[model samples]
Target: MTALGPAASLRDAYGAALVELGERDPGLVVLDADLSGSTRTQLFGQRFPDRFFNVGVMEPTMMSIAAGLSLGGRTVFASTFAVFAAGQAYNFVRQSVCYNRANVKIVATHGGLLVGGDGGTHQMVEDIGLMRGLPGMTVVVPSDAATTRAATFALAERNGPAYVRLTRESLPTVTDGSFRIGRAAELRSGNDLTVVAVGALVARGLELADDLARLGISVRVLDAASVKPFDEAAILKAARETGAILVLEEHSVLTGVGALVAAVTAEGHPVPVRRIGVPDLFGESGDPWALLDRFGMSMQRIRDEAWDLLRLRGRVE
Candidate 1:
C-alpha cells in the first residue's frame, strides 16, 4: 500500500513557488549555479529573466552574488544541488551569507540519499547538520511538495540566512496541515511511542505507524520539518507522555535532527530515545527506497527498534 494518491516532486513545487513569489514581490531575485534545469529554478528564470542570474557552475559565485543581491534589499534565492550548495560553496555561504546576515535563501535540491544512482558524490546528507549549526540560520526540510511550497513563502518572509533541503525523488504528501517554520505537526497520536520523522521519511514513518497500530503498538508520528528551531516543546511533550521516542531522517544519524530531539528530551524530560537513519557510511548507488531499506530505514527496522525500546521499558511482553 502507498501513503497517498500520487507521488509529487518537491523541486517542481519549489520552482513553481518561485514563480508565484516573484509575481507578487518584485524584490524576489533568484540565482542558480548552472543547475537550474535540475533544481527547477529555470522556470522562474524564464518568467523573470531580469531578476534571475545563472552563475554557470560557479557555486561559490552563486552564493556570494545572492548575498550581494540581498544586501541591496532584495530577497534572494540561490539554488543548486545539495553537494555544491553545502559542500562546494560552503565557504561563501558561511562568510558572505550567514556571517554577513544576508537575506539569502539557499533552497538546495538533491539532498540526502534520495538521489538514487548518483552515488555519494552527488548525494548530500550533511547539509542539515551544516546549516543548523550556523548562527541565525533557519533550516527547513519539508516532508512533501505541498509543504515545500508553504515553506518557500514563509522563508521568503523571514529575515536572515535560511536553508531548505529538497530530495530528488518524488514523495507522497503526508499532511494537509499548514506549514510554520520551527513548528512540528503531530500526524498520529499515541501513548506507547512517538516517531519523529523529517523529509521523505515522514511518509514512511506514517506508513509504519499504521502497521504498528495493527500490532497494538499505538505509535505516534511527528512531522519534524523544521530542524533549526525544532519543536522542542512538542518532542519533549511526546517524550513525557509516550515514555519513548524514535527519530527518523534521510540524513546520517550523527549531528542530525535526531540528536536535537534526544538533547531536548534528555535535558527537559529524559526518555528512551532511539534513532533510525543512515549510518556514518557514505551513500551508495541504488534505488532510493531500496537503499533506505538497506541503510536500516525500513519498517522492519522500525518494528525491531520499537520493540527493543519498549521491551527495555517493560512496555512490551
Candidate 2:
C-alpha cells in the first residue's frame, strides 16, 4: 500500500465532494439549517446559490423541506451539525426521510468529542447511535478525507435515506483507495486477533496493528466505515478465524458500532469481543487529542485492548 500523509478535514472534503456532485447532477440540491459556513456547505452555496437553501436554524423544518424536494424529483443533501441532525430533525428524519424512504442524504459534521473546546453541547458522540436505530437508514462514518469523498459521491448516487457522520478535526489518511459501501476493508492480515474499527478510530487501529506486529502479535484490522447494513459476514469470518475481535470507535460505547459488532459476533461466531470507545458521559472542553486519550480513543489504548482481548480469547478457546 502507498503511504498516506495528513488527510483533508471532513468539512473540506465534504465541501469539495458535494460541489463535484452538483456539477455532475443538476438535481442535486443542498439544504443547510443556518450552518452553511460552519458545516462547510458554503462552498456549494458559492458555486450554486440558487440550488443551495439555508432554512434558518430550524432543523426539523429543513428536513421536511428536503424530503419534499426529494419527492419532487430532487436529490437533497441536508448539511448541519450532528446534534441538530440527530436532535432537532430526529422525528422529521424518522418520518420524512426514513419512513417515507426519501432519497435524502443527511450530512452532519463535527461528530464525537473531537469537536473539542465546544464542550458537551456541540460534541455529538451519540449521533450514530440515534441514527442507526432508524429504519431504512444507512449510517456511514468515513474514516478519512479520501473515504469521505468516496462516501459523499456514493450517497449522492444512491436513492434513499443515508446519514453521514463527519469529524471537526483533520485526521491521518490511512486509505487512499476507493471503498464500497457496506464492505469492510482489511488493513492488515493476522490470525491472532481482529480489530474492527470505524470512523476516526480506524487510523489508530491500523497503527495499533502495525505496533502489535512488532511485538510478535499479528493483528488484523478492518475498517468498517459503513455502519448500517454492516458487513456481518466479514465480521463473522474474522471472529471465527481469529477467535477474538476488538471493535473501536470515537463515539459512546453503548448502542454504537461496538455494541452492534458485539451483538453480531455473539449471535454468529461466538468469539470474545472487546469494545473501546467513550464511556457513558459527556465530554468537557479540552484539546481533541487529549480528550481522545482521556476517552480511550488513542492508538495506545487500542493496542492494549487488543492484547487483553487476545489473552482472554486464548484462555476461552
Candidate 3:
C-alpha cells in the first residue's frame, strides 16, 4: 500500500483558495466573524484587507453583509466556525443568501466532532444537516486538504448560497484532489461491497478497502464530498452492483449524507445500507481523533462492521 503524504489542514487550503480566487476575480471579497485566525481566513484578510470584512463576533451580521455584497455582483465568501456559521447565522443565511440565491460561499471551519478540546458547542455535528436542509444550498464537504481547495474553487465558480464544511486539524493527503460539485470520487474499485464516506472517514474507507482486499473481499470506496445535489446515480449503481453499502461520515447520522444515500438507494434500487456516524447525541471536549476513536470509529470497528455486512450476504464465513 502506498503511504499517504504529510498531514495538512483544510482551513489553510480554504484560505489559500480564497486568495487565489481573489487574484483572478477582482470583485471577490471575504468576510470573517471574529474567528479569522481559527478559520485561517486571516491569510486572505491580510492579502486583501480592502475587500475583507471583519465583522467582530456577529456571524449574522457577517452573513448579511456577504449577501448584500453579492447583490452588488461581488463574489462573497463568509468565514467562521461551523456552529456559528450554520447555527447562529441560520436566519441570515436562509433569508439573505439561500432565499435570494446570492453568490455567497459559506466556507466554515472546525466542523464535525474534530474541534479537539473546544467541547460540544464548537464541535458542530449538525452543521451539514442544517445547511443541506436549506433550499438552493449547495453543500460540499471535502475529504482532505487538496480536495478542500477544489471544493472552494467549485463553490466560487458558481452563483448561489453554498457551504463547505472543514475540520480544525490536519488530515493525511489520500486523494488526488479531483473534486467537482455534485459528483463523488471513486477512490478504490471493488465488486463485493461499497463504502460511501466524507471527511477523514474517506481515508478510513480507503484503508478498509485495502485490508478487506487481502481477505478476498473487494470494497469499493467512494469519496462523497458533495452532500447536496448528491450523485444518486453513483449510489444506485453501487447498490445494484455491490448489493450492500456502508455510509460513514463525521456528521449526524440522522440527517446527513447517510440519510441522503439511503433515500436515493431506496428510491432507485433497494439495498441494505448501514450508516455509521455521530449518534443522536452531542459532542464533548477531547482530542479530535481520540474522541472519534473512543466513539468507536476505529479501523477495527469499521472492519468488523464490513465483515458483518458481508456475512449477512453469505460472502464471509
lDDT of each: 0.89, 0.87, 0.88
| Highest TM-score model number | 3
Question: In terms of lDDT, which candidate is strongest?
Answer: 1
Per residue, candidate 2 scores C-alpha lDDT tens digits across 64-180 of: 889999987788999999989998789999998899889899999989998899998888888889999999899899889888998999888788999999998888887765778
lDDT for predicted candidate 2 compared with the true structure: 0.87
Q: How many clashes does the backbone of model 1 have?
A: 0
Residue pair clashes in candidate 2: none
Model 3 segments more than 4 A misplaced = none
Residues 55-170, model 3: lDDT tens digits: 99999878888998999788899999999999999999999899988999999998988887989888888888999999999999988999999999888888889999998879
* Root-mean-square deviation of every model: 1.4, 1.8, 1.0
Per-residue lDDT of candidate 1, residues 39-99 (tens digit): 9999999999999999898999888889988997889999999999989988899999999
Off by over 4 Å in 1: 1-5
Determine which window of 10 residues in candidate 3 has minimal summed lDDT.
1-10
Query: What TM-score do all the candidates reach, one by one?
Result: 0.97, 0.96, 0.98
